[model samples]
Target chain A: MIVARIIDSIWATRKAEELNGFKFVLGEELTSEGNGKRRIVAVDIVGAGIGDRVIITTGSSGRKMLGDENIPVDAVVVGIVDDDCNFK
Target chain B: MIVARIIDSIWATRKAEELNGFKFVLGEELTSEGNGKRRIVAVDIVGAGIGDRVIITTGSSGRKMLGDENIPVDAVVVGIVDDDCNFK
Candidate 1:
């Protein structure tokens, strides 16, 4: 799991059928210092918006969050953080 | 997937039961310029050794490579790179 901030939303007309109904967002990892350089595209399962700090899960655990094993996604936003003093 | 070089092997006397028969190696990610700071502990399934550049798959795909979805592993070395024009 990683703590990140949603930076932007992604839209693609032509993608794998399994990804059609999902909303994709770009997230930048959050570290104790600030935002880290690692960025990833993740499915927004928790209705997170831009600038929202979120908890992202990767790999099979991510796909399992969507209740399907066949989705072609490796990262998913599982939760939105209400408050955090660790990162700015 | 990511390209990395095996830096060292890891030995753990106490670990999860599902990881008993697997060999874990420390890998440093490789970039076009040189080695990146990102490092990971991965189960080596392709018999890779130190100094070998290898391809690693993460998540469920990695667990699937070992033919066991129940393994508590997120990364796995799937192949060793024979030759490459890029990266130092």
Candidate 2:
């Protein structure tokens, strides 16, 4: 899992049938090196909001979080980070 | 999925119970710009060998490739690259 912050939400009315009812959010990775920023469109199942720190799982593992293997999702928000966790 | 090359193998005897019997291979991403090399430890399921180009899925989607959601895996080799596809 990678740490990221929800930047915004995506609204796509026309998409694959398997991706219906899933909320998509754009997230920017929070890397230690502070290198080039990488963004990912992740499915939100944890009710995360914009600006919230989150843990995202990518690839097939992300799709599995949605309980579907054939879903065209590559990233998904798995957990919301709290102050107790050290992101440093 | 991201394109990568199998660089080496990892052997860990003591790991999570759900991660037993899985072969972990080190992979380096094959990016277009040739930026800093990104390495990932991915589970091998498609019989990819060292030096072979393969496709990797990260996060839970990667875990789903193993047919188990509870598996403590972050990456998985899903396919072997051939000459037909343009990785450029």
Candidate 3:
């Protein structure tokens, strides 16, 4: 898990049906800038914040997170942070 | 900090303006199915799999993961797993 914040959101029409009832929010990853690698921005909608550590989902499970097997979502807020998540 | 699998997807219509354009994939939380907490399901992208250890973004950063801070996102896949993440 990483510490991050919700900055904004994105909007797109002409999309797939699997992503019909989901909301997408924008967020910034707060990891130490790696070897010249650029920071990342994500899209979510689980009511996170600007200084909270949140858990995210990706890939196939990201697909199973929903249940329809076709929505086109890649990342989702499976759980929220309520305590410390020291990965060290 | 958890392992999961993508099961399916969901679609919605007439949602918040913040969530305009984003893909939603389905995934299931894979944590030993503890205390029968109704195994959780999530929506994500980042091209994960049914048996992958992934890193996700949530909360405010979940929002900032994106650029626009008004699109309405909460969780996102900022990075993928390439090694072991022993959080203990």
How do the candidates rank by lDDT, highest first?
2, 1, 3
Model 1: DockQ score: 0.08
Docking quality of model 2: it rates as incorrect
Model 2, range A1-88, lDDT digits (tens) per residue? 5567899999999999998999999998764355656888988877888998776666665565455668798777765665454423
Docking quality band of candidate 1, CAPRI definitions: incorrect
The candidate 3 chain B region of ten consecutive residues with least summed lDDT is B34-43
**Poorest 10 consecutive residues of model 3 chain A by lDDT?**
A31-40
* A1-88: candidate 3 lDDT, tens digit per residue: 2234455656779667667767676545433332222233434555565555444444443444355556666666544444443321
lDDT of 1 by residue, B1-88 (tens): 4557899999999999989989999998764345345898998866888998765657775665455678798877765655532322
Q: What is the TM-score of chain B alone in each candidate?
A: 0.89, 0.89, 0.60
Residue-pair clashes, model 2: 9
- Candidate 2 lDDT tens digits, B1-88: 8898887765544334455687767677788886655655678999998889999987656675677775545777999999677756
Task: Write the residue-wise lDDT of candidate 3 on B1-88 in tens digits.
Answer: 3444444433333333344465443334445643221122233556665455555555546555567554344555555567566542
lDDT of 1 at B82: 55
User: In model 2, how large is the Cα lDDT of residue A19?
Assistant: 85
lDDT of 1 by residue, A1-88 (tens): 9988887765544333455587777677787776344666678988898899999988777777677665546678999988655544
TM-score of each predicted structure versus truth: 0.51, 0.54, 0.40
lDDT of 2 at A16: 93
